[model samples]
Target: MKVAVHPDRRPSHEAEVIAFSYHRLALDLARHLGRDVNNWYCYAVWASKAVSENLDLSPGSCFLGDVAARLNVPVWLRRPFRRVFLALLGPSYPLALALANRAIFLEMGSLAAELWDADDDYLIRVDETGDFVRRPEFLSALLAPAEEEFLDAVVRLFTKARNATGPERAEFVLGANIALVAYEQQRAQRLLELVLNRPPRWLLQGSWRWLWCALRRRPFHRLAIYTAPHAELAWPARKAERWWVRFYTSRLMVMRTPVGRIQLGRPLPPPKGAAPETVWAPIQDLEVRELVDRFLPSDFDRATAGVGNWLSFDDRMRFIVAYFRMYANVPELFDPPFTSDKLDELEAEMDEGHVPEPYQEWLQKENARRAAAGRGVRGLIARQRYRSPFRSDPDAAALAGFDLTGCVHRRTLRPEAGPEALLCCGIDGELCGDAGGRCGRQA
Candidate 1:
């Protein structure tokens, strides 16, 4: 019943008690599935990536959420299966919840992004006419008597968390379903510092989305969305930035997302009499997000050294090809083969040119030998590839959303805005992602 009693350093009375759906399944899998199932830190597992609109605190629910197939989804069989697991693993639920930390990193945004869409906003909206009502206004109308009071409470929560020790910081954060954090080198402190500073209209909607979309401006392109202190800053155009702030709905749970002197998503502020470009320059450094970038932030947030992956996954053949080869180069892997997006990376120095005559002859002989039998094609059919702990990220496309109109939020906002700098948003819980007069360019 009592799975993880907070760390011994902290008193148990102050800790939270909650439940997870498949706590037992996760625990059993971790214990029995593979002795080598990756070990991910609880902190990294708790962190989030973009697609902020719908985050819920459930077991194994990170950016790389549940990928294991659900074989039993029929209405009649669902309840019984759950009950059986519940009865089997009932007593050790806490152990499962406590150890259910690591999740695989698979995507940049929602994998079921289209399916995840639901009309949950009761306070804000952009009707067909193109006008918008932001969250603050909506919350203000609904929580009228308590809206201002809740805002004050949030400010106080931030203050309390700011003053707490590193271990206790999460206590203040989750109390309000907040993921308050800092930008690089303690640039901004807490999501509220910038969020509250801006008008609600701008807090929920910004002008950057439009600038990125309309003129193809680079807006906050390759910043680190998760905390990756261990990731090496080796990739090109990939500056080391460990700062983020995301707003989401967590059911009866608060995330341990806050750390000290950090700001979530808001850009840094220009100091008194300092050059304004210092702050603005970072925001404008838009570069493309690549597949290698996907491999950087892991669900474990570990160092990048040990995670060496040389061979490419021939999605077509469903096999591990030579480190240098790709589907285009491998002629033998044709005729209804498969490829994996796992190693969908772009190589710097390609593996081209001709194979040496001796090696080529050996490959032909091997192909002939395998072809005479009924095994398969070129590459080795990978039975057990490494299960590296990775953080789920949005696709390169989602990270590059503003430029291409990232989500329903941005896609809906574009046509509503004027051709010039002024921007607008038409989706509910969505704001005009435009720079509006800031860029001075209209549609």
Candidate 2:
């Protein structure tokens, strides 16, 4: 006779069930602590899993509980792994992992009371059964025999992962993990920009088969493809290159590059519900502590020492990868049907002092127009075409569209900010009888 398992009992990956399990234990803590449910780390855990496309472990919230119960794994088994992971990943994994860890721990505690002894330490066994699940007589006893060694292995694995692929791929993976766990909007936005601006180098070159493999089945890989490579360059360098390209395009008018200035959109403050003050997540700090302890092989506190504070390995690699991606994507922005042969022909023609037909026509037209206006042709050609936006350049093309004269005073700061300030500030000032304090501008 075949064993028949209930449909729900067969291990479901349904979002609702996973969410329920994650929120059940996680939200309970918030309630007991008189905290908001949304502020719990589990929310990030669930969100991270949802965003990941290549996770081998079930995205189910109860999966952690199952991993603990079936494998006799200790709740703290992940502690060492977390540090190594974060060290390799940099500051991005903590927020996601913390929430994930919380859910896992809650489920572990619920699954087996013996998992954690009265000493607030998890038990472990070397023989897989975890039969040696006993509290230490002394409070100072280390959790397990291989605890130290295992943490070392984690760091090694991260190193291996970095070596297997370039730093670009590793950063992408780590960034994706961090975004899942990030609590603050600023942090999330920063990660998102990094992910969007720079993709791993693996996605850009190598055999088509290899590129295909890297780009598929992973959320980070997918994002890498979307952002392309050249856009990943540092803002300043990329902006310079784009300005040159735009100037060339305007003169030649042969190629239409999508390469434009990095126009920063209007500043959007975090929403009221997304305030970081209320959502004081502590995963990043914990990961930092773990990494300093595990990798540095010294007694210095990572939190106090600030090991990953200024330009960690991952941080530096991230900018490099992003800028590389930006450079890599540059050639693709030109009109398609462009080939190496065509580029060669163009270069040869330039060397032979032969301007392209279109460019010649444009030059002639510009010369005639200048002559009619009584301006010398030599003067126009001698003018410097490129100008940096960072510096004060009067000749720089308008950053935005034409300015509206009628809306001059209102747009002193920003057009969008003006209306909102007028309405909200006006009402608040009137209600409190505080005219000077109301609105951004004086009433």
Per-model C-alpha lDDT, please?
0.21, 0.27
What would the TM-scores of all predictions be? 0.16, 0.22
Clashes of each: 38, 15
Worst 10-residue stretch by lDDT in candidate 1?
Answer: 316-325
Q: How close is candidate 2 to the true structure, as a TM-score?
A: 0.22
Question: What is the lDDT for 213 in model 1?
Answer: 41
Candidate number with greatest TM-score: 2
Give the lowest summed-lDDT range of ten residues in model 2.
Answer: 1-10
Clashes in predicted model 1: 38
Across 330-363, the per-residue lDDT of candidate 1 in tens digits comes to: 1221111112331121111112222211101112
lDDT of 2 by residue, 61-91 (tens): 2433432444455666755543442233221
